[model samples]
Target: MPSGHANAGYRRLFDRSGLTFGAGFPLTGTNRSTPDPEAEIELAKHAESVGFDGLWARDVPTYWPKFGDAGQTFDTWPWLSHVAAHTDEIALGTSSVVLPLRHPLHVAKSAATVDRLSDGRLVLGVASGDRDPEYPAFDVDPDSRGELFRESVEALRTVWREDYPELEDRWGRLEGDLDVVPNPTEETIPLLPTGNSRQSDEWIAEHGDGWLFYHLPESTLESYIRQWREATADKPFAIAIRVELADDPAAGPEPLHLGFRAGVEWYRDYFRRLEGYGLDHAIVGLQNDDRERAFETFAAEIIERV
Candidate 1:
């Protein structure tokens, strides 16, 4: 198997040599249904201009208002394509696309299209979805999501790697007579399975090109990284963290749901420590009122220092 460096998006976000960083969307920092798209675009451009390695988006097929956050509100493919058109070299990614809700072939075509449009800067982070209502909304059986997720992943790889590949399972059959077009810029798109997606650690280690996890406590995070390193050789391990940069440069870390609040200096050392533990990448969601300045500040202080 070829390493992630073979894929441009994967290369931008991961390196066996050290850890890299990316910024996640809803960059506007809005928790509501409508985030300012124009503002988000400018922030995306700003992030790239300031040397952020990648720009990531979320896939929320249907927003249940109860969920509280709308996650960028735009559908994944077109939004990423639009971003691709505006940016030049920054990697484009999905924080995750729910695999079980969508047909594998559609995911293949859309993902390949983004990869082609972006000149191979697309890296897929796929998940099985968490919301209970979301499954029934898609006419998907909740109990079978694990199987569906596995089948979807295998299907994606098969279609991307082989032209008109024969495939059969939950979604009918492809008889090797018809093909999905616009293959990924590499032999295969970099596939990072988000969280467990109902799969075991062993399954994720074997099938995923990388692993995307949420923020964990320092000890737990270190343990996961160590276990991942032992199980998979050279594959990247990534985490998406919510960041709240305190005004004090030396403030200690306080917990958030999937991340923490701390001073830039602490973050710098924390990331360095993570790098020492063999972590490869981090996707940050900046939770600050003045996010633009926070981005510049973090980039200058934390990113540069790290």
Candidate 2:
């Protein structure tokens, strides 16, 4: 894919070489409970001020206690729009929207609205619905989610790029007589399919503008990046990691949820290693009681150094 074809958010958050770092939303301490709205906004501004490339928001329509995370506890569209209004320059991303749970047209409209509102700072990350309980609650078939995921991606592209495009699929049909309004800031918003969305690697590589992956060990991540490079030459590859910065600057790495508890020096090395493997971006969630200090430390110690 040509670099110029992507939206500002995509370009700002990714590059052909090296890695850009982004901060995940709900920047307050990790309690999984509802975070203060005011504090979140403040931390968001702080993140951009410190030079983080992007800010990510997750989509969790309903709270599933068993799942153990509320994911910002708000709808992705409004929450992102709110964040966009409060900050400038920092890219705004949907860590992922659950595509199969919502209609494609609705997703298209909401995504484009945010993109336009943010002046092309929306990088949409979409995923097949993962929570089993969400399937029946939304009256959607879990068995057909893979197909729905594919169709949703196709529908979004059609509605965004074409005027009243004729699109017929398992979801519904667009007759070419009606059009979705509020096109994205660019020709189309960057669509990054998350964790394969139950689709084949070939399907994802062919359809997605980029790919969003979960945290993996260094060796495993290298293998995945090698495979991704083989599949697509220029599309970006991003991973999300839960990071806890140890106060001691030289503390060795200790395993945590999907990431690590390490000193600042270790993080710098880790990010450099990721860049060496051709990883484009890292969405980091800081686990700390003092969110402000964490942002500053990460900016000075890891993001800047890397």
Candidate 3:
């Protein structure tokens, strides 16, 4: 189950048996953009201390009032760097960065720098832009994002693997002179494509080191896992799950839009079923105000046992 990169994050994710869990940020789970920064850093450290395998950050360039969630409220690189300084052993990852909104060169340089700083613990998840307003904001045509995403993924591989390799793309042209440095701690970092990003499933399985998907229904997820396994044997499949841990251990599962509200035993069984169906990782987001209690309880009862 090696995902080509020996980076700690990649290994922790793809090289494991069954499913391991990670905490998604903001650990506080506030619906708004602004969160207490100090609290977030502290919770991040606490999450690692309690045996979570990884910490994930989201890439939200701007806060849209209509969308109602600003996603960790900090640029992915700087915020993750701050957290990286405080924790050891816990892998750091971008739940995803929107590739179509950014210049590939900048994305490569920033990601590689973080990979180096984290000592090969970074797992980069990339995606095409989703919001329609975002396309206009970035002066990009909405229809062109799919191709842009493909080109960005290609550009990232080129810049990271070769020094000043000649390439031309929608963003710019590279003439084999200037290079994006400092190289990652490994030969290159792993690139997990989030969702379809407007590409065919075959295209994602072909190019992605792994796949980052959102929560899906049981039968649908099982079907997706089957398709992914058939296309790329042993490539990782991960999803972000919203968890509401009920106090009673015996509580049955009550579904949320993209996750579940249940007690530890139910979640344990639920994750085990997903693991049995070939899911490698579950990025859990605790949607409770008492995040500390929820995190500790979830880890002790579910993560420890599972």
Candidate 4:
């Protein structure tokens, strides 16, 4: 949270929690037919005011029209820009931009712009895209995404940190004295790879600044964390989770993929568990099963509690 924004509140909260807490956005009102950007901005501002560490946005291309759970359901860059302009202190993150479906040069340019605009609060999350519908539209082979994703990441680094370097990659080639303008602070944006994306655990630990994983039982989660720590031996780790709150604190566990449907007390206890596991960040996606009630209830009982 040591961002370009000159807000000491950001620094204080980060220092006190020793963990990054965030909320995913595009708060689609359950009964509303479409998203309202203005309303969303208000929600984002509220999240920041309440001392959340970061805010995450998801890219939902095509929505497949039926993915049912389109987190942000918007173009990644535009949404990030909108949020970055409005927020003064909280770190802005993309859950991930599917690298294989995009040109890394474009990503590099756009991300750097956001970083500069936000005073260096951008943390890019990249992944080998899933959702087969998008592959055909982009002319990207889903099967080859792993290789393309790897190459794109390399290309981004070249364009950002080097000038006029000879670049050779499966995607294409670049030569001459050229570099992406307005490089991000630190000379690079932190690249957090979601899941494995066909990269081995060791490979991820070696290359990624952090690993993004779905929720898991603490023991299982710790095992994966241990593997990453052993492999990296010199880097940090990050993790995230999704949760749906029941008005009742004892609502009990209901099955949710990579997450859970529970109560405020349960959520706080679980977050404490994750922190105990040495997680540096936790981005919670508030499920939309009950929309308004869920948002208000969780924000009051759980979000503030954490």
Model 4 vs. true fold: TM: 0.86
List candidate 1 segments past 4 Å from native: 1-4
Q: Estimate the TM-score for candidate 1.
A: 0.97
Predicted candidate 2 versus true structure: per-residue lDDT over 31-115, tens digit per residue: 3788898999999999999989999999988888898888998789999999999999889998799999999999999999999
Q: What is the alpha-carbon lDDT of model 1 when measured against the actual structure?
A: 0.90
Worst 10 residues of 2 by lDDT: 1-10
Whole-model lDDT values for every prediction: 0.90, 0.89, 0.88, 0.72
Q: How many angstroms is residue 128 displaced in model 2 relative to the true structure, after the best TM-score fit?
A: 0.5
Q: Estimate each model's TM-score.
A: 0.97, 0.97, 0.97, 0.86
lDDT of 3: 0.88
Which has the higher lDDT value, candidate number 2 or candidate number 4? 2
lDDT of 4 by residue, 75-189 (tens): 7788888998888888888878889988888898888888788877787778897788889998888889889988888898778778665688876677765666777765577
